[model samples]
Target: MAAFNFTPSDTSLFILMGIPGLEAAHIWISIPFFTFYIISLLGNFTVVFVVGKEQSLHKPMYLLICMLALTDIGMSTSIVPKALFIFWFNLKGITVNGCLAQMFFLYAIAIMHSAILVTMAFDRYVAICSPLRYTTILTNARIAKLGLVGLTRAVFFILPEPLFLSRLPFCANQIIPHTYCDHIVVAKMSCGDITVSRLYGLVIAVIVIGFDLTLIGLSYGLIIRAVLRISSKKANLKALKTCTAHICVMLTAYTPILFSILTHRFGQGITPHIHIILANLCFIVPPMLNPIIYGVKTKELRDKVGKCRRSSLAATDFKPA
Candidate 1:
C-alpha cells in the first residue's frame, strides 16, 4: 500500500467534481439541489417530530412512518451538504477519510431506507391481509424490534465497505466524477484489485435490496388478493387506498436507484453527466417526496398535519410578533 504509485501523501484529499461536463452550471444546479435539500430536511423532520409528539400517531403504521422519515433525513443529510459545498463554493477537496465516512453513512442509511420500506410493506400486508391479527402481530414492541433489526442490518453490512476501501491504494488524480463519494466509484479508483469489493457490493445489493424488493412484491401480491375478495367496490377501493402512500414511496425510493444501477452496468454509451444526474437523483428525490406523499395520501396523517399547522398558526397569532 505504501509503495503504490498513486498512494496518498500526508495531505491527501479527493476532489469531488460537481458534474462532469456541466462545471460552468454548478451554481445554477445548486438552485434545485438546495431546494430538494431544504424540502427533504423540513418534510422528513416534520413527519418525525409530529409523529413523536402526537399520542394518536403511536401505532405500528405511524411508527413505521417515523422510521422511514428518519431514514430519509439521514440519507439526504449524508450527501447533500457536501454536494452543495462543492457546487456552491467549488470546495471539492475532501480528505480520504472524510470521503470514506461519507460513503459509509450515505450507503448505510440508504440500505436502512430499503429495510424500513420492507418492514412497512409487512405492516401493510398484515393490516390489509390479516386484519384480525394486525394489532397482535405488529405491536409497539414488535415495531421497535423491527426498527432495531433494520438499523443493525444496515450498519453491519455497510460497516465493512469503508474498511475495505481504506486498505486499497488510491489514484494520484483523486478526482471522483460526481458530487459525492460512492463505494463503486471509489473502489474503481484504487490501484489494487477491486474484484472482491465489486462482488461484495453486488452481493449486498442483491441480498439487501433485491431480497427486500422480492418480499415487498410478495406482500403486495397477497394484499391485492385479499383486496379482490371484498364484495363492495367502495370497500375494496378504501383498502387499496391505504397502500397508496407506501406504494408511492416505494416507487420514489426504488426507481431512481434501479435506474442508476441499470445505467451504470449496461448503459456504457450514456453520457457521464446523465449518469451523475441519475446518481444524485436517487439520493435526493425520495427523501424530498416521501413525507409529501404520506401527508397527502394518508388521511389520518394529513388530518394530524392540518391540525398541527392550525395550532401553530394560532400560537403564532397570539405571540408578540
Candidate 2:
C-alpha cells in the first residue's frame, strides 16, 4: 500500500467559489441569515437555561428538550458564525485541519440532534402510551444515564467522518465553495478514490438516521393507536396535538436529509446544486425553526420562557445598592 501522500494546501479560495460548479449567492443572503442565527441562539439558549433552572421542568420530556436545545445550539454554532464571516468579509479560506474540525463538530452535533429526537420520542411514548410506567421507566437517574448513553452514541457514530476527512489527500485546489466545511464537498475534493468514503458516509447515515427514523415512527404509531382507542374525543385530540410539533420538526429535519442523499447518489448534473441548497437548508432551517415550533405548540415551554423573563426583570428592578 502506497503511503497516503497528504499534502496540505496553502492556497485559499474564495468560499463562494469553493464548490465545483455552483455560484455564490449575493451578500444580501446574510441579512436574513443573521436574523435567523440570532433567534436560533436566543431560543435554544433560553430552553437550556429554563430547563436547567426550573425544578418542575426537570422531567424526562424537558430533559430531552434541554438536550435537543443544546444540540441545536451546537449545530448553529458550528455553521452560522463562520458562514456570516464568509459572507461579510469574504474570509472563506480554511486549512485542511480546520475544515476537518468543522466537519467533526457539524456532523457530530447533527447526529446528536437525531439521537436527542429519538430519546424525546421515547420519552413521549412512555408518557402517553405507558403512563402508568412512565415514572418507573424514566426516573431521574435513568434519564441521566440515557442522556449519557445518547451523547456517547452520537460521538462514536460521527467519529469516522472527521477521521476519514483527515486521512484524505487534498488536491491543489483547496477552496471550499460553500460557506462552511460540508462533508460531501470536502470528500469530493479528495485526490484519491472516495468510493469507500462515500460508502461509509452512506452506511453511517443509514445506521443513525435510519434507526432513529424507524424508532420515531414506531413510537408515533403506537401513540396514535393508543389515542384512537381512547373513549373521549377531547382526550384523543389533545394527545394528537401533543405530537404535532415533534412530527413537524422530524419532517423538516428528515426530508432534506433524504432529498440530499437521493440527489447526491442518483441525480445527475444540475441536481447537485439543488442537493447543496437542500443540504444547507437541512442544517440552517431546522435549527432556526425547531425552537419556534416547540414554543408555539408546547404551552409549557412558552410559559416557562415567559416566567423566566419576568423573573429576570423583577430581579433587575430590585437592586439594593
Candidate 2, residue 217: how far the Cα is off, in Å: 1.1
Q: Compared with the true structure, what per-residue lDDT tens digits does model 1 show for residues 1-321?
A: 221223345337787887989989999999999999999999998999889989999999999999999988988899888888888877777888999999889998998889899999999999988899988999999989988898899889998888888999886667789899988988988889988898988899889877999999999999999999999999999999999999999999998888888998899999999999998899999999999999989888889888899999998889574
Steric clash pairs (candidate 1) = none
- Candidate 1 CA-lDDT value: 0.88
lDDT of 2 by residue, 1-321 (tens): 011222345333313332235435636677777888888898888888888999999988888778787888888788778777766665555556777788888888898888878878888888889899989999888877877887788788778887886777767766566767777778888788887778888788889888999999899899988988999999988888887888888887888888877777777775555665566677887887888888898899899889999999999899796
**Least well predicted 10-residue stretch by lDDT in candidate 2:** 1-10
| Number of the predicted model whose lDDT against the real structure is largest | 1
Alpha carbon lDDT of each predicted model: 0.88, 0.77
- Give the CA lDDT, 0 to 100, for residue 308 in model 2: 91
TM-score of 2: 0.89
Winning model by TM-score: 1
